[model samples]
Target: MMTMPTISNQNGAFPLLRKTELRRLLTEKQLQQLEQFCRASSKRAGSTLFRQGDPADTFHLLADGMVELRARPPGRRVYRTVELIGPSCTFGDEALFGETTYLTSSRVLETARVLALTRPAFDRLAANHPDIALGVLRCAGNCLIKTIRRSAILTQAPADVGLRMLLEELAGGNGNGAPIPVRITHAQLAGVLHVSRETVSRMLGQLASEGTVEVGRGIIRISSH
Candidate 1:
């Protein structure tokens, strides 16, 4: 719980969320309505944005840098990182629904710019601007869908399959049935897959022999087909 620095314009105008999935869900006027409640903050690494079980009174969007969302299990001493959120992603949408709390804590992984919309502010906006409210809900719904989809892939797919899917996602696909080379280490892949470094390296070697990927140093170039 380090100190946090925040900046809110007099008019409450923050346009940084334009890069998020929300931008597609909201019309220009609806987006303006939502922005009127925005408060921006610059947080250093190690800053705690919110904690598990905290009253979910604010929704957050990362305008820049990264944050780690983590949770401690009932008997665990250390928190496990569940996700690494990047720019334009919204989180803590539990605030948008009534009487809910955060399931995990968010910590700044890098110096970050965050935009927050408080519950009270959102309440007022919802009352006066239902269209905007609905738009925000739609965006949150889409996020939930992606989370469910990602969970399915991680839990249901085999290790090598899951790794391939993850690589495709990170590579962002080259659109012509090819994957752009991505720079990442075996340790990073192991952390995400909840496997060991040796396991990731072995899988990569297998994939290389199969002509599925070429791994060198710290990068992986996945085959198109």
Candidate 2:
């Protein structure tokens, strides 16, 4: 069964106008058309926004909260989470390019405010604002490609190196080479690394003993040394 969100009216210029890229991509009249057309919806936690193999009639931009995308093989019972979408992100985007069905299922992990646009609405916009729709598609596709590439680079590497590199990335380079502590768990690390929990634990413990990383409750701090 799928969970559905209730429609809500929005006032003022549509939220998409607030995005700089969209603002630059759209004309004044097109922007007004969007404001008049777009609306908002609130999805409760545990809501199944869409299911695998469902028709892809709409794509959504998340305003806040988390949505998890999970995939199960055509005849398999096992489902694995493929992505976690945060606020200000887009999902169901293949529909924008004419993909007929969803490859994965989308479930709300927390209460989420979403701005959903159907294929018909997008078509209406594209009639007069083709560039506007393409611009959003380009941004979304680039972001998705970059994320996939980064994840591949991280997870496909050897375990110890992968963990170190991922932590450094989270630390966001303070310029002086000091890295802030990042809160994460062994299970999460294992999942991303495609390694066993014991492997992650042993590797982390070894690094901690070498004075290279400080491991605390659900957090790992990289030593300045």
Candidate 3:
């Protein structure tokens, strides 16, 4: 039996819902009319929005907050960590582009405000907003570049190096600066490295022992020293 979507009301008069499946989450008609795009219906904190290999049936416009994109390894290990995408970003875009499913999993780091866009609605907007469409194309290109870089890193670099590269990206460079908060689990890290979870735990322990990084519950911090 098909399950009905649940709806909740909070922070606004309208209710949050997962219904309207296969419909455009946003409409060009609404945009052309200058009506507010869907209001912040709901917020998610430390939530997994989608999993790797899941069907890409919807797209999302992040109003605020961070989203991490992770990819599962080739083996049977269940974890993945490819990259982290920031606010004002569009994700779950494969549904609009091609037959491909969601290539990566997206997780929300904190309370996030997002607008959902179904495929048809996205298509209509793309038809009218050539500039916006091109912009999204560019973003997709950037996503591809990051994906390729991650693949190369894991294929050639050691686990520590892979972990370092992740830290560098998160820290936004400048080794002397404070390390960014990495909100992920060791199992996820292992998936990115295609290594065992135990290996990741051990490596992190070694780093902590050497004063290279600090570990916390649901957070990892790299040391500037």
Residue 1 displacement in candidate 3 (angstroms)? 14
lDDT of 2 by residue, 1-225 (tens): 366755343434366445423455567766666755456677777788889889998877776666777788678797665665656667888678789998888988667777777888888877866777776676567657855886798778988998777666545454455645755567656655667879989999998898778888866887654
The Cα local distance difference test for each model comes to 0.75, 0.70, 0.61
Kindly report which residue pairs in candidate 3 clash with one another.
Answer: 25-118
Poorest stretch of ten by lDDT in candidate 1:
5-14
For the record, the alpha-carbon RMSD of candidate 1 to the native fold, in angstroms, is 4.6
User: What's each prediction's clash count?
Assistant: 0, 0, 1
As for lDDT, the candidate ahead, 1 or 2, is 1
Stretches > 4 Å off in candidate 2: 4-13, 16-32, 160-193, 196-225
Measured on C-alpha atoms, candidate 3 has an lDDT of: 0.61
Per-model C-alpha RMSD: 4.6, 5.1, 7.2
Which candidate number would show the highest lDDT if scored against the true structure?
1
Q: How accurate locally is residue 87 in candidate 1, as Cα lDDT from 0 to 100?
A: 68
Candidate 1 lDDT, tens digit per residue, 58-164?
A: 98877777676777789888766666565667788778877578887887766777878899888887898888878777877777777678867775888888888
TM-score of 1: 0.73
Question: How well does candidate 2 match the true structure, expressed as C-alpha RMSD?
Answer: 5.1
TM-scores, all models, native as reference: 0.73, 0.68, 0.67
Query: Candidate 2 vs candidate 3: which has greater lDDT?
Result: 2
Q: What is the Å distance of residue 98 in model 2 from its true position?
A: 2.1
